[model samples]
Target: MSESFNWHKAVTKKWDQNVAFWSEKSRSMWNEGSRSGIIPFVKRYVPVGSQMADIGCGDGYGAFLLSEAGYDVTGVDISPKMIEHANQISGDRLIFKQGDLAELPFEQHTYDGLMAINSLEWTEDPKHALDELYRVLKPGGRLCIAVLGPTAGPRQNSYRRLYGEDVICNTMMPWEFEQLASETGWRTLDGYGVFKEGVKEDVSHMPKPLQQALTFLWVFMLEKQ
Candidate 1:
């Protein structure tokens, strides 16, 4: 299969067979990082009453948060399971749909802002996806993109390497990611390395390599040119 198809399949399988597991993990992050760190950062630039689109928005938790914050939010994901979960969790505050990130179904200039947290790394064509984002967003719309950095600590690395059995695809370094974003016409607005620390569910799975390397590195925010 093509790389893009393979990545899509991996996410599909995760949602179909392991939706609860991934949802719980994503939910945990929503409480601390997505709610407190990410949403606040995005809100700083996106004015109130703006229309926002959250691409690759698994389970729509982020979209729910943004809608609750007063943005007209539409969340889209590739996985039906994810969209279903999101619809169930979100109620009327957020709208959830299943769609491709690279070929969003929305019309041109549909939204005033966009958010793609931890979702770009899974795309086979990051540049194409960003171009679509540029098309859907209004002129000078703010975009906040967060992806799993190349150095996401030992535990995650170990889990993907061991239990995932190499099903994990690729992760880009910060500089490479920034270059791609810029080349795709996303202006670098304000960005910072966000670091998050957490232990595994079991003590036996803990790694003793804290501070051994940069863990959970992600760009905070950016904008469409």
Candidate 2:
């Protein structure tokens, strides 16, 4: 197999092994932060009753929040263990499925909006994954994505130490991320830095000097053109 495939496999295995730990941790804190940090930003662009996909939706907490907010939500993750836990909470308007970010299972133009919070950075090919997300979204649909930024710092280093050198994580500067969105046929509607309390729109696009000054997770709102 290719190096990329092996790296992805290792990442998936690591998540599978830690699903229980992550599930507990998510419920304790991460879920609450997401509700305050990203959910409201997403809701502003995607109205109720729209179909939405929560890509890389571990344990489905984010998806559940979107569902409760009135969207028909589908949560997808590569880890079967995560999907299994997610399915426990699934219902009429919420569906959880095991799937890869680079190859989403849905048909073209299937969703009105999609969110891939903290997930794309782990993909072997972020550009390919972005393309896949673009394909599945209906024309003019919105996408909200969050990924590790330059500020990932020690947390990222610790992952390499724990998961081995082959583990994949690709972080980009704010301008690079904006350019990627433009190249992939998505127009940047808004972008921000996500904090534990809420989202900040200050870091959307930055010069190299300013980019170097900021060290935080990035959340972007993009629209298909």
Per-candidate TM equals 0.80, 0.84
Residue range with the least summed lDDT across 10 consecutive positions in model 1: 204-213
Residues 10-62, model 1: lDDT tens digits: 65666566568767877677776533577777889999788898898887777
Root-mean-square deviation of candidate 2: 3.8
Decoy 1 TM-score against native: 0.80
For every model shown, the clashing-pair count is 1, 0
Scored by lDDT, model 2 comes in at 0.79
Candidate whose TM-score is highest: 2
Regions of model 2 farther than 4 Å from truth = 1-5, 28-31, 153-165, 195-213
Give the clash total for candidate 1: 1
Q: Which stretches of candidate 1 lie over 4 Å from their true place?
A: 1-7, 33-35, 153-168, 196-215
Task: Judging by lDDT against the true structure, name the best candidate.
Answer: 2
